[model samples]
Target chain A: MQENKHIIELKYLSKYYKGSNVPAIDNINLNIDKGEIYGLLGPNGAGKTTTISILCGLFGPTSGNVFIDGMEFQHSAEKIKSIIGVVPQEIALYPSLTAKENLTFFGHLYGLKGKHLKTRIDECLELFGLEKNANRRIKTFSGGMKRRINLIAGILHKPKIIYLDEPTVGIDVQSRKVILEHLKNINKEGTTIIYTSHYMEEAENFCSRVAIIDKGKILTEGKPKELITAKGEYTDLESIFLNITGRALRDE
Target chain B: MLRLLSSIYKELLVLIRDRAGLAILFIMPLVLILIMTVIQDATFRTVKEVNISMILVNNDKDSLGEAISEGLYASDFFQIVEEINGEKITEENAKELVARGDYKIGIIIPERATEAIRGNVNALINKSFKSFNIPGVKKRTKKSTIDITIYIDPATSNSFKNMVMSSLKEFTSQLEIEMFFKNFSEAMAQLMPDQKPIKFDSFETIRYKEVYASTTENEILPNSVQHNVPAWTMFAMFFIVLPLAGNIIKERDDGSAFRLKTMPGSFVTVMFSKIFVFLGVSFVQFILMLLVGVYIMPALGLPQLEIGPHKIALAVMALSSGLAATGYGVAIGTIATTHEQAATFGAVSIIIFAALGGIWVPVYVMPHTIRIISQFSPLHWGLNGFYDIFLRGGDLMVVLAEAGKLLTFFVIMLGVAIVYNNYNKTK
Candidate 1:
């Protein structure tokens, strides 16, 4: 484990998917120190997920090594995984499993058990206003309800670092506020937060620093206000990102 | 009636939407029956195959030994494994073959089996002499007799012995009638001392090697419903792979799989849990299907699915079959990239196996090549097991052989699923 302020380091990471003509991510090097809420701001298909997946050891980069808290994924994947939580962009839950069952399962996955695990699940469910619906299957949940449970699922073990890929996407304003607030509360409690979103206003107010990526390349990386200053006249990240990466559709 | 028709209409709609489910619900069973019916008429005639294979020990080289050997060999209910038969098979070898489970039954025609024939003939001659009532006629008779020993493997169903004995009894009666006619011919010669001998040995019994395992001479009626019910039950059980694969693919495509990766358990743990769940589902499926087969079918005027004297054998069948189906389900479910892909692959593979395994057509009706292919199907082993207990009245050991096959399939498929999951994770 690294005894330094920076808890994560991505060194020259690139991912070329099998049979694909182009790499999903290309030569990306980045670092996020402890006690910072970082965001990867990008349009869809802009390699934001590719970067987070590598960071969480979901898949290995074809041409790079990742070090989480100075532990290389190749050597200490389990140890790294213990301290990192991942919230995937999709609502990743068993529709057949109740909220309590899902939480208990994921909690045990992170090595929680017994009354302590039960207590933690109750706490998480209560915090997300889902204590009443604990026994209801996740499939019956609305998009926002599922999103809240999804966030709670990732953070069950109180990992030192949590990565969320579009955690607030496609949810009601109330759900988005609760999720964003909870993410902030965890960051205050010393969890390093890395989130990605195309919503400029959310990233501007939320992340301490943000990297805007396009076509597998990072066009700019800085504290949001500083990036805005560099653009000379743009008031918010939307104008800055649009100006730097263009407004044409990037779907392919 | 309107509601019933509409319900069927709704079901059809659901099936159409589910390409995999539709194939299983209609295509597999229909294809199985069609293929078997076609094979049933084509050069493969209709002699029912006996599930029992016998190891014959004929030590007597006389006419009596040939009669015993040929009688069983010709019977539709018995398969005399010729490669292992002949005078070379000693009592010890026969016992060992049965004990080692290479064969379920062993029959020994003792070294002096000719005495059985001679004794009967002599008795007839003496009776003829007494009936003449001549002044100096003597009443002398042969007192020798040979015991035919049938060694049955207790591990198998007692029904096998019954079948063999049934055939043997028929053989004895026929032998007695022939000897009586031959003696009558001889008596005529003794009385007249002028006629050439009348041959009494021109009997031609039914031959059924072409139809394979002909049981016609034995008059062993097959419980067709028992065969059909368990067969389609297995076909349905293995089709558990469809929903299993669908669930896995759904999890994968929807991100639950990725969440699981970030969670603490190894991929093997996740796969095993799915298998365990499916095993439970399969067990329930077996019980309900069999309930319908045994009680409901008979109530509805169909042949009862006979459990015979081996209810534990049925339990073992259910347990092993459940695991086998679940293992198959877990394997394909994890390997397929999409739910439809998994469903298609699992359904098609199971249907092909069901057809080849004699689920619709009896294995006897298949072409020789297809019969050989059927052995490779786990469904074949399962069907053979059901037939053992139902038709052949086989015992525990008989069912164990089939259960062992299903268990082996479970182990192999589970191993593959685990390996494939880990491989995918690593890559």
Candidate 2:
């Protein structure tokens, strides 16, 4: 593999939130190659969101180096932001704006304009089976529709890398299928995907490579089938995850 | 530039769709301006148009009593009421009316006041003739002074009481001078009977004139419209905080702000866009308020607002004021954690600034300490700028200092917001 093949490099990434003794993410290291569907799987308070947030440059880690597309965040934040998209755990969209309007706004922020922006928005809407509701406000949308629109807003600029945090946590099965299938198509187009989710089975099937993280550290990291095979007693990724992270409650 | 324009467009769209917020941004200020202007106009008219009612008891019923009575009636400031309920008012009754607050002032002429004045004048003239060694001059009687009592309501302001007392003194001084001339002429006629008797009319040596100080040739007196128009307009402009801050809190809560933060440009771009949109709203609110003062108020029997001749200065002041108000809104929105906190603090803080800014009453009338505190309020700077143009007939140079203060306040508030936002992101 070429030196530039790895699109994202997280070297000793650690984060300690203000006024808290415990680190949210401690000395975590990962290198995500281009065109890979990578899942950061864990339970609540498992540092999955923290690692994703750092990768998306929503904030910087306390002591770490994050290199996105061979560029550092501090020196090339704007340049890095242009090539990446972020879909937060929340449905981050203006309820008053229509689906097309929301996509247009996000597209503008990403420096897309005119016919190109309009064309991209139309294509995304059609691909998501939401072309008919393009002019309808998000407030009038269903949970699944809103989630789809939120996803579209992030991907409108066709960024080279995308970070999705719980993208389909609360949605109908059909909407989830449509979203995951579209994500797969994007990933096939050489876009790197960094995803976080609590669904063990979804992660096992969707991610090309998976890392099960807990207590601010990764417990295991490998291809889903390989990880399951490595644990001979566990038949699937769900059993493997339970065996590694334990049944202890992490509700805090 | 494209980023800025697009962000501004997005903010405008979001603001337009929030109909309730739009109404609060526009109609609340409009109604407040109209209602407050009307209410204040009534109070202003009472002070400007109506006369202070006073009861007068003329016990002398002679020249001194008649002269004072005529003087009070001649002035437009006083409404003399000699008889109440069809009964002639006595000195005791006059005092009782004034003490009861039925009358703001009362004047009583002592019995034989005219005779006393005449006797004093005649004695002085006789003594002057005797000094000249003229024989047959009557023996000079002892000079006597008459005391005229004035009763004032305890509630009457000391300044108003002084004005009434000064007017009464003028009447008595004129009467005394005329009596002196008459008595001197009588003494001269008695000395030389052959000379034809000369007659004279009452004359004034000096006259007093009152004028409002202003730079322009035509000075606009401070009236309710002139005052309330700009006062409440500044108030309304600052009131933009409620909707502006509320919208920011909403964006933060809905996660759109976080999404924007992750976009291509700086989040400052979005903040600038919000400031521009809300600044436009404040300008609209200001113009509507001025229109109400100019057109609506006159129709409702109040004096039309005089915006003065410094149109350019007024626009500059308005722009600075709008910027300051929007900056404050952004600061509050950035600092507050929730919509409830933002809305409550934004509204209450603006109201406090308004009160201190002389929106309810002019700073000149406020207590000394409050007046000093008022200077710190951006609304006060804006109001002073408006007042300089409207009441003082000042130009751009005259209002520049106030405009500068408002602009400085804007910069400080914007800086605070930026710093607080940056701090929040790091934490």
Candidate 3:
């Protein structure tokens, strides 16, 4: 109420899917500041995707208020969407389309067009080291190239907030490094990055502040180093994660 | 606006790249129109131009048999075969030929059929003279009833049998009337002895003239090309459901749909883009089908498809039908959970609708229940709209009635898709 400076704020958020007795995400509160890299780490079925989905405005929470850049989703849905870019875990680009074509199409969805859209597409392809393969169909690309193109599509409109779900999953070291490097550069440009990952070490090093979430509840939230130091006998974020969420199988 | 256009352009690019989908969209329908037109052309000719074969055994080579043979020969409907293997066909042989399906009908005139008819007429005339108490009127006994046996193939349709029977009845009635008039004139001359014989001219009191029921001055008769062109075109237009629905399912499965949901503006932009693109595909399909109907069908020795002068009506009908098909595809895509489900249901459902809509067979020939159900099919409405223009010479107002139904179907299907999509999301 006192002019909250955070770029994103979630208040008592919960989601109970239809016909399910358990809530996917229950009574969660979170705050992500501008230009900060925030990682949400969780085990399988731990509600990471659900929380991200709600934040992306993919679906409304069962009971909660979501505010993005000081505006509520109810009143500023389009405005919020325009400012937020989403890179889903899946290779979201059309397989039959060339990398440039896929990028141009996504750019147009964000209202970018003509020479501007073309120039942006070319720049992204060049930065991703995919300029040579820009004309190649996505179906013809390797998994890493596809993942890179997927990332480029999300950031083509130069959004202020980027929500990435497992963006580095199932990709090679070279593609992952290039992607993380570019994402860091984008963050340096004052874009708030909210990312989810199963990689604990990566999250520990990459995220400025992190939240360990499981069973629809946030277990802890703080800077990675501070969190590591506070939790005695745990050397790194992986041990901290295993200790908190446990090593038991969450086959779901 | 740019988003819609860009999305439409994207969908077109994707569609153009899919060779299999392109073939299903263009080649399948063109080949279907050609093949179906060629196949149905024969059936149509059977009704219009081709003659039905009949076996004739004339035991009485007198007036009745000669008259019947001459009448059958004169009419263009029948090709009478009087012999087989250079041997005269007997009554039993004619029946066997008809029963074995070698011919559609067989006619056998009984022996002395003309004499029997003459004797009966003479007896009736003598009885009339006796009733009037004319002098020297001799009483005469009526002859046995003359039976002209007709053998009809069991496989022949009842309607065809009725037509053949009616034609035969007309011939026999004329012959009987002629015989009666001749006998009466002879008896009158004998009774009067001084009066000249009266000559009766064969003049039909009422004549039947066949013409197509149409609104235009120049009527285009319904033929195979006219029927198959629009029927299969509508079928092909609706067949867009397969590729369109498959595209949607692929987007959802691959997560592009989710990404789109997270994009600027509403997802309706994307759905509308698909609709716009696929609707254009449907139009292209319709046009190609018409071209095949007009040119290719005629080249294949089938009657030319006569699309009436109502160009605006035809365009309106095509647009509405295309929209309806696209809308259905979207609805199926939204409702189905997987590509297999969408493709199978889309294809089977379109075929079912086409069948019900009289694509495979005309609605008039369908059973009462199916015919009633056909009224509900979008293809039926589209086919009727085309028929109204092509065959019935209907104006814009008449086609609008059908186009309105098709557009309503489009709106309803779109609404269902939207509602289902939202429901799935919320759930």
Candidate 4:
């Protein structure tokens, strides 16, 4: 039943760091279909970033195999990487480079070049309202502006799959709205996205499906409303997340 | 390949826009060459006072010849080249030795030089007393004169020539006084018992009949500009570590390197791009510094730096030195965690290396221990390569060891950098 429907599959995924008894991510198994906005929701230290990082092949899981588009990460990393993009939680843009230059470099990295990449860059910048400051160095931009440029850098190639680790993190509501709307529009165009967020309300509204995780293990997995109804008498996703992952602050 | 090109292109763009960095790379070296040339070359130093080697051929074998030979052998200034055959060196052979190149000055003493000087003194005594009709002095007088021949290669420096000629005046003056005193002592003995009277040492007896046999190749001698140009240029090339390391550390801290990892290419591609960009920058630096040394220094009233006969050797040595410096830059980039850490660590360590390698001073001036110490420095290898071609007129084969050593150092350092980077970074 899962064949041909799921684009990403993780089998018994586990990651145990050196000198630590507990695993960072333990015995995880999941499958997400293509063209769906799948969210990995958790509090801090919930392994949301770690799962996304591994999915992007940032590092290997201690004991597991990840298959994306029917190609294993270990065997076909180059192919899988070419079709995927990652927007990390940290601002990954070069401060010395202008927004346009940064985008152009990322485009060339993904084998996009010539006038085609240029036109695509212009369209993306215009859509994000960053065309006005395309030539300004990222160091001169505001926090919100830098975040938007960072987002633009990841999508420059228009990858088939994008993994965003908190795309709207630490920005004003205006910048947040612009970023979320663009993401939704891209998703509507049939690109699969794996999004990790601590914002329960946003994930409930945005994700077609989500897995609530805690202590490196998934507690529940389903549609937000279904999971909300199933877990006790919680009326909303945020209360359900709190009741599941607990009110205690988890730090890595 | 296109990704590599784009990455290198971006690195070049960033480097070009760094005005302060470019100024340090270009202007500091050129300006330092000028300043050092003015200070190190302005003072006049004697050739013999600074360890000059010459061939000495003495057929006199007398006290005079012995005195001159001993002077050279004992003085720290002159280094005498002893003939291996033990045969008395002829004037012709001495000139040939000087002409062959490394030795610029040759000394040859003719036979009977002391006898000729003694005879001339007696004749002068007889003539002085001719007006008084001194019979015995006139009867004992013999007429002869000493002629000291100096065969020098015309290519010898004016200062060395002057130094050689200045010694001639001293020989003549000292001999003349001895001859005069000897004649007077003998004249006084005629009035006494003739029992080996109170006579001073004879001037003609201890006098040296020596002159430059001829000049040889003076091209190998290093002047101010030749010395300062290469030393300061290589020193400046290594300073690239500052900007290079700063770029690396900044990218790592700002998360650009991590982003690059998740992009299209492998880790090797990005690393190769950075190293290639640095190599290009170093090459440009080498060319610019050479232009200043070979062309600009002369226009500014300084001695023009020589590229010697083999221009290809110069080019090869320059490339090797640049690559070695860049390799060091790569290694420093990996080890340093912060910009300040990278900059200061590289700066201080290189400065120490330069100091210990005799870059700031001529290796000849270094003591035996320091000379041994200098052999371990990569800067010393590069400086030796430059010196071989610039000062020693060494061919490619002659300079191959220095260049090879530098290239080997480049390989080792580059290997360490790559492995260290691979270890720190996730695959």
Winner by lDDT: 3
* Candidate 2 lDDT by residue in tens digits, B275-376: 999999998888888888889889988889988778899999999999999999999989999988988998888888888988876689999999899889
Best-fitting candidate, measured by DockQ? 3
Ranking by TM-score: 3, 2, 4, 1
Residue B371 local lDDT, model 4: 84
Candidate 4 residue B95 C-alpha distance from true site, Å: 47
> Which 10-residue window of candidate 1 chain B scores lowest in summed lDDT?
B211-220
lDDT over C-alpha atoms for residue B93 of model 1: 82
Q: What DockQ does each candidate score versus the true complex, computed on alpha carbons?
A: 0.21, 0.64, 0.75, 0.45
Model 2 chain B, poorest ten-residue lDDT window?
A: B134-143
CA lDDT of each prediction against the hidden true structure: 0.76, 0.87, 0.89, 0.80
TM-score of every candidate relative to the true structure: 0.67, 0.86, 0.93, 0.73
Candidate 1 lDDT over A1-252, as tens digits, reads: 555647888878888877787878889888898988999988888899878888887778888767788898778888888999989989887776679877776777677778999999999888889999999988899999999999998999999999999999999999999999988999999999999997899999999999999878889999999998888888999999998888787885
Which ranges of candidate 2 are over 4 A from the true structure? Answer: A228-252, B52-68, B78-201, B216-222, B355-375
Better of 1 and 3 by lDDT: 3
Better of 1 and 3 by TM-score: 3
Query: Compared with the true structure, what per-residue lDDT tens digits does model 4 show for residues A18-60?
Result: 6678888899999988898999998888888778878877778
Candidate 4, clashing residue pairs?
Answer: B150-B212, B151-B212, B151-B213, B151-B214, B152-B213, B152-B214, B152-B215, B153-B214, B153-B215, B178-B203
Chain B in candidate 2 has what TM-score? 0.84
Candidate 3 - CAPRI tier? medium
Give the lowest summed-lDDT range of ten residues in model 3 chain B. B135-144
Best by the TM-score measure: 3
